[model samples]
Target chain A: MGTRAAGQVGRSGPVAWMALPALVFFLVFGVVPLFGVLVLSFTQWDGIGAINPAGLSNWRSVLSDPGLPHALWVTFEIMILSWLVQTPLSLLLGVFLAGRQRYRAFLAVLYFVPLLLSSAAIAITYKALLDPNFGLGAGLNIGFLTQDWLGKDNLALGVVIFVVSWQFIPFHSLIYQGGVRQIPTTMYEAASIDGAGRLRQFFSITVPQLKYTIITSSTLMVVGSLTFFDLIFVLTAGGPGDATRVLALDMYKRGFQANLMGPASVIAVLLVLIGLALALILRRLGGSTTASQQEGA
Target chain B: MAVATSAQATSRREAPGTSYGRKLLRLNWLGGTAGWLWLVIVIVPIYWIVITSFKDQSAFFAQNPFALPAEPTLANYQLVIESDFPRYFLNSVIITAGTIIPAVAIAFMAAYAIIRGAGSKFLAGVNGLFLMGLAIPLQATIIPVYLLIIKMHLYDSLLAIILPSIAFSIPLSVLVLTNFIRDVPKELFESMRVDGATEWGMLRSLALPLTRPALVTVSIYNGLGVWNGFLLPLILTQSPDKRPLPLALWTFQGQYSVNVPAVLASVVLTTLPIVVLYAIGRRQLLSGLTAGFSR
Candidate 1:
């Protein structure tokens, strides 16, 4: 028995080593930097000079700053608003594309083009397209088609949300389509026998069946909206007057652009905390997302 | 709104296949309207982009933004090509390939280990760590990553971008790849073990081939992310020559802010490679993505 047990251990030993390369890479870069961000938050560094220990001063200033709250509010607003706009649209489109018709399939192909373009490319396209003087409206002679879309506070926020939806709705729709297809047709058939109308069937059968998918897609959307740096940076640079400044962008401006690495690290830590809290809350709302998704599959 | 076709009508009459009967009742007018409406919303920008890219600078101003170019010109493309565009393209290619190959390779190995050695406590813990790693917002770690890169003297190098990208790709790749590896039947492994094939041998021969579709799926998914990655390249590399396509496009736009057609041409040029790859792998990429996420 002892010999056989030793033999088993010997066999499994090599298998364990197989996981080492990825684990080491993740630890050095991923895990270590996670702690590194926290450590840097406590010290002062100008991003190009030697770091100096500053204790809790960085935290105190960041915590008291009005800009922090405004940035947080903007982040939450974008998060909630984008969620509001994207969820139903994606769900509807997902169900629409779930059909195997050639036309629907063709539509699916075009719908995803926005997903393939880099965020920078998308932002640049929209910036030019929304130029009030020379943009689409002027060229097409349509009133209300053009505005200083990225110039004002309210309109800039609205354009950011619109652009976010324009890019991601298709990807989320694809997720929902996959989720919708996994529902057993027998359930729909049973509902039909009871004379459930299409809307009734949708609410009762389709929505209920797609619970996990909704959570997965929602989590992706909400967490994703937190990190809207590249797009906003390219589109408005958090302008016309810091109207579209998000948490991630705030961190970038504080650290890199403003040369205040310490305060930027503080914001980075805040982002990490908020991200964790949200992911945990979402997971609690619907069991383990990955586990439920795997079971559904 | 329900644009019923002969195919749909025929499918409705035929015996209800897995999805056919559902489709008949699921004919949603609202959904159809929204889908077609969204199609127009999606296509108009793309059409404008392509058509505008072919127009000359003066023509861009004089003509309808939506019009197909009357006297199409290659000047924009030529100008973009002259502005170190190929260098940036090559840089993007190198960073993407450098990151994806090793990232996918190591992630696959890690996934294989986790699945095969499931009962082992260490492997289970490692898997759990990766799952937790998924929740960590990678962008938040940029400051520290920048510091580390500087410390390691890798700042302003493509390797600086590639290294962190690989780290970030690990968590999801391991998760997706593990799920794929788990779906392989135990009996197959048992049979291989009985044949005296070592774990390494089985991994190379059995697990590798069986997970080929999944490998492709994970590759395309990661490749797209890294190819279109803006943050890493933006933060890590400083030199103009070192810039990836996305970063290059940004600088190009900055320099040619007035040259609208030239900027649009640069956008088209950067996206053209991915479009070609998509056309070739559309089926695998689409189905693979649906399965990857849904699964």
Candidate 2:
């Protein structure tokens, strides 16, 4: 590859040669497969049967399927729950840790434990703890507390939402912490001097300063919600009669287990579309805050 | 209390409604308590798993759930080790290396090219492609990947898992590595060119050594994801012998569903290697991650 640029190596020439392998990999793996998915989406194909053109039928079936609506509802439920729970917790911890001088490093590392563990590992730990028969909760004789968390139809998804938020809070916290650290301490000092209490100063200063980070982290959470599969897959396997059957899990079930490739691709495309739309909205919202803040300053 | 700084004491004694200018001067007990509580929540499950790994089945049932093992035994661990744990571990090692090495290597080149060839339309297009790759979730792509692997006759092999994992990881690696490479001063490249260094020579001598930490960071970051991956292994590979640790643990549960101690012991064994690596090399890994935000 470098041979082409051996004698006539312009500024871009060698660089292009260096980039060739990576470009090829993405083209083959990333770009081509994406197109393959799109083409495959419009065709009805079981893994073994002759592929037949769907003529909009696959899209129609996927959209019209009763499961789709329920899964969508459940997915959004998890999203809203995670956002509501994960955001405040991450921000609180992030802001507190950034402002403190003591045990900051120790606490950050400790909090980061769940982030590093595989989702599977975390699922197993929780499953063990929430075990109906002899789990930690049950073993401890907390009658009201223990309720077959994973096995029940009503509680399984809530437990999943809690666990997923727990696992991801640290990641979002680090982002928020960085944003908080960048805010000038002088701003807080001035606010305090102006008769603003800690609560008042937090709203007036910390929230405004962290606008962009909040948007970024929120977009990530939204996307995480859209594509959540591992925890659901690991713990309950979307069980107790579709109590936790999320879109990603639905896609997996349809594609792999049920062998419905077209519908699965439809689900995938829908997920990507939702993710893009949300990201764009967040970016616009985040950008406006920066502009407004600049004017205020 | 006697050793408290004047600023800390003053801030604490300041009236509740009246604000104090001294910030970070006093411990915010409310926030401190909240932070400590969150830490306990995060660590307790891990503590339970680790402690439970040592207890025998009877001890695990008889003793308190969070209690230390009264008659700690290595029997569960031994049973797991004898039951194909080594094979599963080896498979994971091979798969992780297969994914990370190529993904990071190719990404380095691409990042280098993107930085040095900044003005080129093609390079810019490549950069955009990697960005697009970031938004594509793994769930949507699995059906196609499964079909492609079957088409290529690579299904159920470690190669199958490795290929798609590398594809998914390259976008982030390229993004991070490109940011790092752009920070390498232009003068370094200019000086190298003046010495008649070819692009290959320049990359070997200058770029590789400079971005070495990013390389390690990308490798470990992607390696860990692949190591813990469940979806790909669950769908792509079918053989019990070929399953990685996560899948192995999942299957281990099914086989030993009655034996809770053994299942947790297997989980502990699966996670131990990464935990050790994290404990030792955390600062370097996290700093590399933290550096990404500055850009």
DockQ of each: 0.42, 0.38
lDDT of 2: 0.80
What is candidate 1's local distance difference test score?
0.89
DockQ computed for model 1 against the true two-chain complex using alpha carbons: 0.42
> What lDDT tens digits, residue by residue, belong to model 2 across residues A158-226?
898889988998877877777788788998776555555576567779988787677767877887687
Q: By summed lDDT, which 10 consecutive residues of candidate 1 chain A come out lowest? A: A1-10
Q: With candidate 2 superimposed using the best TM-score fit, by how many Å does residue B235's alpha carbon deviate from the native?
A: 1.4
Give the C-alpha interface root-mean-square deviation per candidate: 5.6, 5.8
lDDT of 1 by residue, A1-297 (tens): 222343665766878899999999999999999999999999999999999999999999999999999999999999999999999999999999998899999899889889889999999999999999888998998889878888999989999999999999999999999999999999878666544557767888999989888987888898889889999999999998888999999999999999999999999999999998998888887865466453333
The number of the candidate with the highest lDDT is: 1
User: What are the lDDT scores of the predictions, listed in order?
Assistant: 0.89, 0.80
Name the top TM-score candidate.
1
Model 2 chain B poorest ten-residue lDDT run: B18-27
C-alpha RMSD over true interface residues, model 1: 5.6
Alpha-carbon runs more than 4 Å astray in model 1: A1-7, A288-297, B1-27
